[model samples]
Target: MKNQAYRMALLYDFYGDMLTDRQKEFYDLYYNEDLSLAEIAENYGITRQGVRDVIVRAEAVLTELEDKTGIIRRFHKMQEQFAQIADALDGICQLNEDRYQDDALEGLCAQIRSVLSDLKQE
Candidate 1:
């Protein structure tokens, strides 16, 4: 359940600008602010059912955008590839330390690690 919410938030982050102003507002209030339908409706001077309708519309928009673009899917794939690359680099670094003790190889590994760290941060 928690993971599903996180995924929705990530999708929103990617394609939220595509939503209408009211859709964005209602979606943010419901998901980010943890507001109930009644509370959001009260604040917006609408019925709870109206608020639910807006939120549902917003979700459909977000999911549709993700389906068309698949940017989120590509991002997760890249993250997994990066982790594999980092693990391989760690093995190479350890081998250098134990067997080769080569300064040049150590420096190169450090550079690769730095680049990986920067990419992961983004």
Candidate 2:
């Protein structure tokens, strides 16, 4: 369906717990596990159309939640800000190293980079 897997995953991440257990299971199988609708239907002992309907309804729920809360939008904005901060830190470190060659400054820069790395990982 136009390769919306990434968007679907992000929506699921933000709002998946709101879904019923059955909806979550089918959504995970179809989207996260990359299973075809037919495969999911086979596994669940349902028609392919039934599996598709569940996934589609789950996706609509996720989209509605995102529209109302805007949490995912804010999250992406925060990530962009963090990336900008990391880039600025990198530039400052480069300038400090070029001008001063101070070991203490280098150590501080290393710590900052480590913190940024950890944040990005999370």
Candidate 3:
């Protein structure tokens, strides 16, 4: 349940602007705010079932969008790749630190860092 909630939050973060205002509100209250369905219904002056229905519909829309676009999946893959690149760079820096005291190693590390910083900004 906790994992599902986290995934829902991530999905919302990625595609929430696509949701209707009411849908976004309900989703935020129910998932992000950790509100009960009854609490959301009371806040919105609706029945618990109505709140549930809206959340279910919102989840469906989010899932459909993810299935079609796969932006979130790609983003995760990119993050993993970046981590791997960073790790490789760290290993190279460590291994070459003793062998090379020149600016070449420092220049290579600086370039990698610059590239990583640019990618993260995107």
Candidate 4:
């Protein structure tokens, strides 16, 4: 259940702008704010089922966008690849410290780490 919610949140992060305003609000309330359907319904003066419908439609939109574009999927893949690169750089840095003590190599690793950090921030 938690993982499902997390995926929905990530989907929203990727494609939320495509949703209608009401759908966006209801989805955010249910997923990000952790609001129950009943609570959101009460605040919005609607039925719980109505709130659920809006959130469901928002989810459908997000999922459809992902299916069409695969942007979120690619983003996750890039993040995993970046992590692998980071780990490799860490190993190289350790080897340098223990054996080589090469200043130029260390500087190169630092540069790569900086670029990796910037990519991950996106």
Best by TM-score: 1
In order of lDDT, best first, we have 1, 2, 3, 4
Superior candidate under lDDT, 1 versus 2: 1
Clashing pairs in 2: none
lDDT of 3 at 1: 88
Model 1 CA lDDT for position 112: 97
Clashing pairs in 3: none
89: Cα error in model 2, Å: 1.0
Report the C-alpha displacement of residue 66, candidate 2, in angstroms.
1.4
User: Per-residue alpha-carbon lDDT of model 3 for 1-122, expressed as tens digits?
Assistant: 88898789889999999999999999999887889999999987999999999999999999999999999999999999999999998888887787776588878998998999799779
Q: Give each model's whole-structure lDDT.
A: 0.94, 0.92, 0.91, 0.91
Give the best candidate by lDDT: 1
lDDT of 4 by residue, 33-70 (tens): 89999999999899999999888888888999999999
Q: List, in order, the clash count of every candidate structure.
A: 0, 0, 0, 0
lDDT of 2 by residue, 1-122 (tens): 65587889899988999999999999999888889999999988999999999998999999999999999999999899898988999898999888988899889989988988898888
Better of 1 and 4 by TM-score: 1
lDDT of 4 at 35: 93
